[model samples]
Structure formats: structure tokens, C-alpha cells
Target: MTGSFGATSTTDEVLAGVDLSGKRILVTGVSAGLGVETARVLAAHGAQVVGAARDLAKAKGATEEVRAQAKNGGGLELVELDLASLKSVRACADALVAAGKPFDIVIANAGVMATPFGKTADGFETQFGTNHLGHFVLVNRIASLMKPGSRLVNLSSSGHRFSDVDLEDPNFDHTPYAEFIAYGRSKTANVLFAVEFDRRHKARGVRATAVHPGGIQTELGRYMTPEVLQGLVDSINANQPAGAQFSWKTIPQGAATSVWAGVVAEADLVGAHFCEDCHVAEIVEGVDIRAGVRSYALDPERAKALWAKSEAMVGERF
Candidate 1:
């Protein structure tokens, strides 16, 4: 399936010649960027998409194109989900469960990037809580809605290379707080969550995988100052081979990997692994290049430990 796709593939290109007619998908963060693009392409290809966002009015406006382009049996529905608040997360999951509609694919796509240190409504560090624990509880709470043969696509990032989950001080009570470090920990948690979730549910045919959307100029970078953004670009350029400077992907290209992993890529190839550029990423370590996944992100034991820690932090067991 990935034979012809790469970093530059767009979402529409990935699903070309494919029919999604009766498939129902749930995508979070549909109010902007890749989430909107992902939902639009899938619905345009004939899949019913349920979009979740913290702001309904914003999402309603953002997804107008999705509704306008929906075809065949495809359609769009809106739901409210504020991942920073456990209360909101649980409420969203409960409402979905009560609705009793099964999802063929669930894309945990909403997230925050580097932000000043803060805590969630539930008192977890903002990045970890919003990016990881919020989706953790919501996904687990709604896991029953995902049937056999279903798949879960978690939107992780190469930023995961920044740090692993700091289980001992997740909230940074004793450690210094750094925005990118927190973002990295949460991203790593995203991958590990997929690892453990796939382990526990693959037998039931529910597969989960994580993907990096590559560098895209999205609202996800709203928090970064020009200097911060420039610093990152400089770092990438410094690490690149001569004349091969880093570049940003278009929104369609950024979203390709998510939809590819969710629908186009073979389940066996993507399940429980981290992917980028529409293919399973190789595990590279002991270097600082802005490609591939880190070994720690795919470690099973670390994934299990993070799972248990997540359950405890969320006060819910799966």
C-alpha cells in the first residue's frame, strides 16, 4: 500500500482509487490543520467522520468544507472534547458510548506543542495531561466502541526525540520544567500508549499505531515565538547534509501519514509501530537527526510502565 507514497504524498493521493463508503471514523482536533484535512479527505472519500473539538462553534466553522465535500454515504458530526479536563474527557466518552455507534477508526489527533509550564484541571502537567492522559482516558473509556478489525491512530511526533516519559516526576514537582521537554514526554507517551494498547487489544483485532506528521506550519505552533521556531530550524539545518536544508510540508502532505496509517497502510505493518512519511519508521538512536523514531519510544517495558502509570494518574483502570 505504501509502495508509491512518501514524505510528499498528500491525503487525497494516499486514498486515491479507494472507497471508504460505510466506514465511520472519529478524529479529534478537527477545528484546524491536519485534523480538518484528515476528516475532509476521508469524508470526501465516503467515510462518515465524527469530529471532536473543545470549541463546537469553531469546529462547526472549520469543518464546513468537510460537509460540503461529503459524498456517497459519508457525512460529518460534531462533538465536544476538551482534552485538558478529565471531566470533559469522561463526558465525551460517555456520550459517545451512549450513542452506540461503532467507529472503524479513531484518530487521536488533537494536541498542544511547547507551552509554558502549567497544570491541567486535574492537576497534571499541562503537556502530559492534555496530550497524553486526556486521550489515554478517553480512548480507553471508549475502547468498547471500537470493534474487531478497527484501528487507532495516535498522532505522535519526532519531538518525542526530546524526552521519554518522566514517570517519577510527570508533573515536574521536583524537576525543572521545560516546554519542549514536556512536549517530548507527552509525545513519547503517545507512542507507548499505542504499543501497550495494541498488545492488549490486537488479539481482538483492534490495532493501534502512532505517526509523525513531519514539519508543517500549523496552528499547533501557535505557542512558539519567532526565535524559538528559528532555533529549531537552525538545529535541523545544522544536522543536515550540505545543501539539504530542512523544509516544511504542506497541510495535505502533513496529514497524509495519519490517514495512511489509519486506512491505507496494511494493519500488520502499522500496528504497534511508529510511522512517518506514510511508512513504518526505522528505529535510529545515539544520534540527533530529525528523522525516524527513537528506540525508547518503542520499548515494550517502558510502554507497560507508562500504561500502569497512566491508569493510576487518571484514576481509571482499563
Candidate 2:
């Protein structure tokens, strides 16, 4: 089914007939998993892909397979980026800016899952800090590097169905912390980011879209313990409709939507929607292990509010 593409698409299948010569793309977290795969297919199609990760050495080692996939002048290079820290985000943005090349597509793919309650370098919750705020700052700083018709793809998750952002206590200062909730809130922030980003920049020719790349098992879940994994399984099982099948995606299957969003002209043109598989997801009324985007995630007012709060937190305006 994934081979046939469409709602069940894989990375290469969508790019199979496309040409990306002269295109420049950026993918975060390319050290492994979906990020590597997303880069691989794009490069294979003849795009120049710059992959950013925290550990350049690890990324260099992990992207070997990705390099092997390059064809048609598609090439991959590693850049140092650690989204958990604001300083690192700035440095990476600075490096990219100095390179003086605007990206045609930006995939904010690197992220963390539910972990033991902890804070990032700037004292924000681990999941919220890295998954949302970090990307928020980086994208803002790098906005100037996106020319008109640029595509910005943020890797959101079906987990956004799990909860909405708690604006008052995103950092867990005023409210009690729950790892899963933190993850959900961060994912929600991802969708909201696209909403506001596209709203703000679409007129300038930059388009932004968010994708829930399905439930693929990846390094994004490294922090989930056996107990946590089982709990996730149980929660999913309980919430899903009767007889709904549970399927974990292969890496290729997981990256289909992000790649599709980046290269497909129609998708880039119709931006600011959260997608699953390779199509715009329907607005779901309530969460029950369904695959549609949440109302709160797409709420315009909430998106604006989150954008303002993010600017305030990051101490910079885009």
C-alpha cells in the first residue's frame, strides 16, 4: 500500500517521478531514523540537503547510508545543532545564515519524546523546550533564509491528540508535570507554530505546514522505558475504536508526509494544515486514537497567543 503511495505513501515513492535540481533543503535530527530517510530521498532526487543534529560526529556516522542514496546531484552535509539549548539554536542559525543560501524546504524533524521530568538548558520542560520552543526560536531566526515559495515542514505527531498546550504552565512552573502531557503539548505547539507561521509569512511567499508522520517507532522514543511504552500501548489500545489495527511504521513510511509536504507543489501551496499519511488531516472533534488533527491545535487565536508567548519566552521577536 505504501508502495502504491497516496494515503499510504513511502519516501521514495512520492519523489520517484519528481526532479529537485537546484533545490536546497534542511532537515533537523538527521543523525538517524526518519530524518536520515527524509534527507536520503530528497538528495536522491537531486536536491542539496543540509542535515542538522546535536552530535556532528554521530550524524556523520549515521548519515552514511543517506550519502549512499544520493543521486542526480543530491548531496547531504551535516551541521551542528542542539535544539535543547537556545545558544546552540542561534549558533546553528548563524552558521546557516552566513552560508548565505536560502532553503527551499525546512523540515524541523528532530525531537524528544516523553522522558523523566527534567529541564532543558534554559530551564524549560524537556519535551516542550526541545520539541517546540527550540524549533520555534530556530525557525524564527532562520526565517530570513527562507525565500518566497519556501516550504517549512514541522514534524508534529498524532500525540497532539493526547492533549492541548497549557499556555499558563508550559514549563511546568505553575502546574504539575506529566511527561506524556508535556509531549502532547509540545506537539500541539508544533501545529500551532505552522498555523501562525503560515499566517504571518505566506504573503511573503513562504509557506508552512505541519505533519503527523504516523506512529513510527524511532529514536524519538529513546526516553520511553518498557513501562512507559506499555502504558502508551495500553492508552492507544483503549482509546482506539474497536477492531482498529495497530501498525508501527517503517522509517520510510514515517517520512512520507514530511517529504511530500516539502516537494509536492500542491501541498506547499496549500500550507498551514496538519497532515497524516500524505493528505491534509480532517479536523477531529475529540481524541479516541483517531488520525485527524485536533481543533485546539488549529485554533487561530490560540496559535497567535502561543506565538506571542513564545516570543516573550525566547526574548526575541521574529
Candidate 3:
């Protein structure tokens, strides 16, 4: 089934009658925005939700909000996770494993966008390190703790259209570090990660998907300079003609697709697809279009190579 919702669809609307009692969901970056909304809706639906954030205080606040929204209340728990560090990722997974309960869905929603050029604690580029490699290790570390039929959702972006993975200089070693290109590479890796992940784990009943949550105005862009933000505003306005005041998605609306992918029963519809607006996206090409996964993002060989490189970097293998 090709289930389709729109950019305007809210989380509650998409999950209207779905019952998730007894299900367990792990959501990363649940401190605010779409991630918080996602945790709220899932917990409200009776899922045992774990809200993972880098800051314990933020996680506590977000969990309280989710609990207040939950019908049964206290269905949410908080965990500390800093995806920029592989050691932290492993530690978080260890804590979850210590809990001895398998996660039914793992949502890799936390990410850094176009931040200033920098290195992660492990010396990898910031965007690539946190957005892709960090999640890469986290998922693999926790893979054994995932029950059969569990789902993994990686939040990619339309920004992926700007560039593909730069295998030669993923860390910007020899090339100048352009923020947008770095972000694009990371987002592209998000898609490719899901592709390779599904290939490896689908037969074992663990499925993976990548999502482009459209252009929601969120804290993800907090690192952008005023000029950069204004340029983005101008570009959106010029292309959309709909008053370009970040007229893309509300947080709840943006979280709808991720929620759907987590709960939707149709396995065929969920895995290895680049989703947008709650449906499988149509393939796109060239510079002018605004739909579908770019071919490079889904290249299987590239995905495998990325997976191998990631395992080496993280010092772990799935």
C-alpha cells in the first residue's frame, strides 16, 4: 500500500486510530520540535517511549511534556545520549541493554544540520560524524537488542539534493569545508545507511527507512548565520511564491511521516524507501525538481562502502 499524507497532516491525524499499547519506541533528540511531538503522540497511543537527548535536563522537560500529553501519563522515560561521540552511543546502548527490553522501533531523529566546520570528538567532520556515523554506531550497537520486526527511521533531508557523499574527502581534509555540502553529504549518508541497513537486517525481520521531513522551521537551523538564513528565506520565497516565510511544515505535521513509518503495518511500504509527506517519494533528477530520492543516495555499492567505512570509524561492526 502506498500510504500518502500531506505536508499539512498532523501526527494525531496520521495516527488517528492506531493502537500502540505494549509497543516500545526509542526516539533520539526528543528535547523539542518534531522529536518531542513524535514522542508525545507515540506515548499518547500507549507505547512505552524512551526520549533520548544529549542534555538530561532537556530530556526531563521534554518527557514531562510528553507525560502530560499521554493518556496514561508517565509512559515516557528519559535517557542521555550524545550522538557526536561513539563512546556515548555505545554507553547509551549499554544502558538500554541493561534494561533488558528490546526496542520495537528506533528513530534516529536527532541530527546537526549546517553547522560551522568542526570535528567531532573522534575527529570526523561534525555533520557527518553526528548525523550519520554517530547514528550508525548507535543502531548497530543496539541492533542485537532490537526485537524482530523492529523499525529504524533515519531522518534525511531534501538538502541531500545539494551533493552526494564525498568518499575521497568525507572529512574535508583536502577540500574547503562548505557547510551546505557537508550537510548534504551527511543527509545523503542517512539515505544510504538505511538502504544498506535494510539489506543486512531485513531478512532477520529488522527493517529500516529514511525520511525527508520537508522544510520545517526548527531549531536544527540555529547554527546558521543571519545572512545564511536570509539567503535561505529568499530562495524559498523565490521558488515557492507562497510568501516564503518558511512555509513548509509545522512540527507536528513534519513528524507525521516518521510516526507512520514506525507504526504502519505494511512492511513492504516501510523499508528502504525515502519517504516524504508520509509516502514513498518519486525519484527526482537534475537541479530544478523537488521530489524523490536522488540516484546517488540509493546507490547500493556506495551504501555498502559507507557502511564498511563507518564500521571502521566507529570500531564496531553489525
Best by TM-score: 1
**Against the true structure, candidate 2 has what lDDT?**
0.87
Measured with C-alpha atoms, the lDDT of residue 270 in candidate 3 is 66
Model 2 poorest ten-residue lDDT run? 1-10
TM-score of each model, in listed order: 0.98, 0.95, 0.94
- The collision pairs in model 3 are none
Quantify all predictions' global Cα lDDT against the true fold: 0.95, 0.87, 0.85
Which of the two, 1 or 3, has more lDDT?
1
TM-score, candidate 3, is 0.94
Q: Write the per-residue lDDT of candidate 3 for residues 80-100, one digit (tens) a residue.
A: 899988779889988888888
Better of 2 and 3 by TM-score: 2
Candidate 3 yields a Cα-based lDDT of 0.85
Give all candidate RMSDs, comma-separated: 0.9, 2.1, 2.1
lDDT of 1 by residue, 1-318 (tens): 666899999998999988999999999999999999999999999999999999999999999999999998899999999999999999999999999999999999999999899999999999999999999999999999999999999999999999988999999999999999999999999999999999999999999999999999999999999898999999888987787678899999999999999999999999999999999999977436878899999999999999999999988999
The ten-residue window of minimal lDDT in model 1 covers 283-292
Error of 3 at 72 (Å): 4.7
